[model samples]
Target: MPHVEKAVKDWQQQFAGLKTSAANLMQIAFPPLEIMQSPTGCCETRLHWQDQDSEASGYVCIDDFVQATLQFENVPHSVAGQALDEVFGLGWFNGAELGVRQAGEGVYYWTDETNAAEWEVSVLPGGLANLSIEYTNAPDIATLLDALHTAYEDPHEDDAAT
Candidate 1:
């Protein structure tokens, strides 16, 4: 287990920028997503919510800031793929499926220009394996915003510039 905070502050901090970025990039307008605490030791310490429209949603279950289990959905395969990077700090390469370089036996990875983050993957036979890399260490992010910025050139576009 890496580490993950059982809090929603991260989402709160990025929601506005995420919303704007999604709008600019995806061209699909969605109101703010109110990430709600899904209080549970009974289930999992997590935060959950649905995006304002599109039934698309994401949830982060960070029992103790040790690590997180994240998931989101959208109609498009590409858009859905983008979520792992945008909604979660995990997509360093932004386009790994386009191509991935072998890192080791049965393993491949994609890295951002700064090497700040990477999507370490185990392309197991039929995609079944348990190779894990701590994707939560990312912050300045090709891992953070690339998915949301997939369509926009200026991924780091300041909200004030809008």
Candidate 2:
């Protein structure tokens, strides 16, 4: 797994431009979202969902500079992960072992690596399984984001009735 962590640095390096760019990119990539800032200075988006049951969230942090984190949650760990394995052409993680890959930026995956077909899964409370991915920069990010946007924007039967 590839890892890079920067320790505390001078205040002068605090750059807002990069952080702003990351925030802007997120808006362009995601559907209608609710964003919030933490008292600790981290920027976070409330869990966004396509259907009422499934939920997801994303985050961006800036201290000395900008660091964007991309994550999606509540994906059906089995089917969804298999689909991604086929769509992205990579082995899936099952939320047990760690998997890492690189593209525009380094990405680390946490899931059960044992389940080849199950893919990256995080077993939530009550045995609900989910898939999550975190990355700073990646080539497939745009395509994946667009797909997610489409899913989120699609009109649902419940929404249409309302």
Candidate 3:
């Protein structure tokens, strides 16, 4: 079996409680997982999401989008294949107006006229998956982090008795 446990633990800190856009993306991308924070303030999760891609037909797609990056953990190879199908199916037959291309065995690229993103998947020995997402020409992730910090500030701090 692969070193799925330790591998996920390594990244789990960074994957723990997210804020702003990061939290939003986490909610959308991994609806089944719980976003928690470690004592050290890093993100963590234990749920493994199976890959899912379907020819979704709706007006809910993005428009003039600048950028987006989505990451996941413990995904299976079979799920990866399913995601590949979803991306290609939308690109080729659904008039989704996006570009999809395979970069290598476990790498895929999705892009449009003004935005670009990549999905890289690495499978551990036990068939566990580690996925990394990167995006260009989109909102900075730091912005999301900042939003989280800002939300935690006390509203009455400035008004405290002098």
Candidate 3's TM-score reads 0.35
Model 2, runs deviating above 4 Å: 1-14, 38-65, 76-87, 90-120, 123-129, 138-143, 153-162
User: Residue 154 in candidate 1 has what lDDT?
Assistant: 29
Per-candidate TM-score against the hidden true structure: 0.34, 0.45, 0.35
Q: Highest lDDT among the candidates is held by which one?
A: 2
Error of 3 at 132 (Å): 2.3
Q: Scored by Cα lDDT, where does model 1 land?
A: 0.36
Per-residue accuracy of model 2 over 94-160 as CA lDDT, tens digit each: 2322221211112224333332212233444332234444433422343455555653455232411
lDDT by residue (tens digit), candidate 3, 1-162: 369888888665544432334445534443433434343222222122333343211101111232334354554433433344343443431222232212223334344434445544454444333445456322433232233223222222342111
How many Å off is the CA of 38 in candidate 3?
7.1
Off by over 4 Å in 3: 1-25, 38-68, 90-113, 122-129, 136-162
Candidate 1: which stretches are off by over 4 Å?
Answer: 1-33, 41-45, 81-135, 138-142, 149-162
Q: After superposition, how far is residue 28 of candidate 3 from its true place, in Å?
A: 4.7
